[model samples]
Target chain A: MLVIEGLLKRYPDGFEALKGVDVTIEDGELVALIGPSGAGKSTLIRCVNRLVEPTEGTIELNELELTTLNRAGLRRARRRMAMIFQNYALVERLTVMENVLSGRLGSVGFFKSLFRRFPQDDVDNAFALLEKVGLEGLHDRRADALSGGQQQRVGIARALMQDPDILLVDEPTASLDPRTARQVMGLLADLCEEHGLAAIINIHDVPLARDYTDRILGLKAGELVFDGPPEELTDDVLPEIYGGEDWSKEPSEDDEEEEDIRSSGQFLAEEVL
Target chain B: MPVEQREDTVVWRRRDKRQAVIHWFVTLGIAAVVLWCFKLIADDTTWEFVWSAPEQGADLAIRMFLPEWFVDIPQLWRDGELWVHVAEYFRQRGLYAMELWDPLVDTIHIATLGTVLGVMIASPLAFLAARNTTPSTTFVRPIALALLVTSRSVNSLIWALLLVVIIGPGMLAGIIAIALRSVGFCGKLLYEAIEEIDENTRDAVKSTGASGMQVLTFGVIPQIAPAFAGISIYRWDINIREATILGLVGAGGIGMALQSAIDTLAWGQVSVIFLAILATVVLSEWVSAKARAAVT
Candidate 1:
């Protein structure tokens, strides 16, 4: 289980990104963190990994307190959690195999990794994870050579190569096409099921999150306004989380398609302006 | 601030009236100062030499056009016996005299060795200077910057002048001079490259529980590899040109040949040295360009 108590992140400029938030997540839970832009969804996920240091909080992963860990202790603690990025942040020049193997850097010695001499077991696990993530024969290709969907798959393979207990995914589908986004989300959900791993996914697409995740945590301006099963995240609650946005319309299949076209058209109009 | 509402119309200007007046006065002041300096220079000038300069330059060019392919330098060979045969053999093929070959090779060595040494010293200093990579900004960065600035402020020719006196005038002096100058050029460009690296990619690697060294190896190095390569090769190309002139200060290269030829009033041999230096510079440019293209 992962537990966060009074998690606070106030930047140097005194902007509070996470305001004394408290939450708990159990194993095998696929929790979707949904909010509009600047709503602290990304901040909360990064804070759990201590990528963005919290101003004040206790982040306990499995029984160990993460916030209090020193440099070496933090590295050790971080090994239990792997993060996925929206940009699929692979070292673009490195081969997919090398990028995947980099996930094992925490356990490997510096010289060993420096010479590309990863342990044989880690190499084998890397190959297995690559195959598991549906990148069976593309390991030798450079990360930049892959398409958006393919690169995200590589990112997933890299994260799984760490053998972590939980995944902190930041806007994983933000840059992807709708179909690829859904596929990636489905894959994450499936992998969570297969490995019995907990995942905290920061997602902007409400329908996609509801479709793939078991629970939804809604945040608004650094505050967790709603936390419940996806079924409980009704239209009425969305306005409270998103703040005054029109949520009365039915989000049916056809309506979602219309919304996609409308949004894209709005983007095109803005670009022209 | 420059926008104004005049009756029913709105007007926009790049500058307000006061600013435009100031800009006009600044331009007038600059032009007046330039004319005054030119008049001072004209008043102090030797007009006779200025008028005869074209005639003197043409006469020199005619002499330089007929380059001497063979020369007897008593400093070379075993008391002139070996020199005659070698000069005759090379002159038949229209190649440079044997005296120029050793110094040409020495110039190449100076450039190559200097660039390698510079890269060695600059790599660590670059890491210290880069904002994202430095261990301590307040303590270490200023020291690294100071070292880079010291290396940069003095030209390689001046460095060679000092080194020739201390190290006693050899290829060693030329190499150190080039290396010292290169450290600043390479370090400044490399650190800027490091600072501009994709922070997201680095953060992702750090998020994987990678250690500091691992983050650099996997995250940072790959991002900056192309920039590092291009900078090093570009510096090497410049160092080749710089090395050719290092011998002017007694640091050992083609410039020594040119200096000696000028001292003996051998204009033909001086022209040959100029041609040789030009060809070497062009070749280095081509190689560096190809190498930089391949990496990027």
Candidate 2:
């Protein structure tokens, strides 16, 4: 289980990216964080990992108090939580196998990693994870040579290679097409179920999040305004999260496909409720 | 739409006439300055000597090619043992063809060793100078930048001269000079490469709970490897050229031989040394190109 209390992130320049926020997440649950741009979803996720340190907060993962750990302690704590980036941030010049194996960096000694002499088991596990993510036979290929979806698959494989207890994903599908986005979301959901690993995904696509995740946390302007099951995230609640946007309007021509998905998701949510 | 079009037209028409006048005045001022500089040079120069320069160059070329010893080559070749006669001729002129072999080898060693040393020193300095990797921006960055600037400001020739004075003239001085001169060049390029690495990749590595050193080795080094290899090879190519000339300051290399040849007006030997230098430079260029291609 992961618990965050009174989380605050005020930048050195006096901008608060995350206000006092509190949340608790159980293991084996997939939670989606939904908000408009600059709503602090990314900041919240980053603070959990101490990538962006909290100004004032207590983040307890399993039983470890993450905020109070020193640098070395923080790194050790970070090993249990893997992060996936929006950009599929595999080192583009490195081979796929190398990028996947880099997940063991926190566990491996410095000289061992520097020389790329990862233990046989680590190498085998990396290969296995790559196969699990459906990137088999691509171990020798460079990361940049893969397409966007393929690269994200590699990103997923790398995250899993850490054997993390919890996954923090930031806008994982933001750069992918809709079909690919759904596929990635489904993959993340399946992985979470199979491994019993808790995941918090920050996403912009509300319909996808509603359809896929077990719970949704809606953030608005650095504060969590709503947190509930997908059915409770009604159209009226969206305005609070996205700052007074008209949710009942007809879809524009450019957003026709997304509108269909939204309507279908709403129908599914009503049926489940 | 019509109102917007009219506003656009009015804005285009509202040109400043004084701007054009200022432009013309600036142009005329630049031209006047250029002509004055030209007049100053022309007034002090001898036009007659300049006009005769081509003829003088041709005369020197002819004399260089028509030395008495070179003219006797054909006559000597008429004898049966041409190879032996040629060897004897070189022996008689005190130019034993083999005398330059050690100096040539020393030049290559100086360049290779210098490049290795320079890259070794530059690599750490580059990380310090790179904004993303520096330990402290205020404390370390300025010192690293000052070192880079000071090394780059002085030319390799000047470095060789200074090192010769300090270290006393030898191949060691030449090697140190080349290494010192190359550090700034390699450091500047390497730090820029380090700074330009993808932030996302770095963050990904960091998020894996990797320590700072681990992040650099796994994330940063891989991205910058190609740039590092290319820069090192290119610097080595340049160092070969600079190493050859370092011998001119009594630091040991082919330049020492060339300097001696010039001091005695041994133009034939000077030509030989020039050809050797050209060959060495071409070889270094080829090697550098091949290495860069292989790396990238």
List DockQ, one per candidate, in order: 0.81, 0.77
**Per-residue C-alpha lDDT of model 1 across residues B1-296, encoded as one tens digit per residue:** 58989999999999998999999999999999999999999999999999999999988886765424225445445465665666664484355556788999999999999999998899999999999999999999999999999998999999999999998999999999999999999999999999999998999899888999999989999999999999999999999999999999999888888888888887767777887888899999999989988998
Q: Which candidate comes out best when scored by TM-score?
A: 1
The CAPRI class of candidate 1 is: high
Candidate 1's C-alpha runs over 4 A off are A250-273, B1-26, B67-96
Count residue pairs with overlapping backbones in model 2: 0
Clashing pairs in 2: none
For residues A1-273, what per-residue lDDT tens digits would candidate 1 score against the true structure?
999999999999999998999999999899999886888988998998888998998999999999989999999988999999999999999999999998898898999999989999999998898888899889899999999999999999889888999999998988987778878999999999999999999987777777889999989889999999989987777778776555554333455654653343222222222
Residue-level lDDT tens digits of model 2 in B117-233: 999999999999999999999999999989998888899899999999998999999999989988999999999999999988998999898989999988899899999999999
How many clashes does each candidate structure show, in the order listed?
Answer: 0, 0
- In angstroms, the error of model 2 at A76 is 0.9
lDDT of 2 by residue, A1-273 (tens): 999999999999999988899999999889999887888999999999988889998999998999999999999999999999999989999899999999999999999988889999999898888888899999999999999999999999999989999999999998998778889999999998999999999988878888889999988889999999999988888777776555666443356665555563333322322
Q: The CA-based lDDT of model 1 is what?
A: 0.88
lDDT of all predictions: 0.88, 0.88
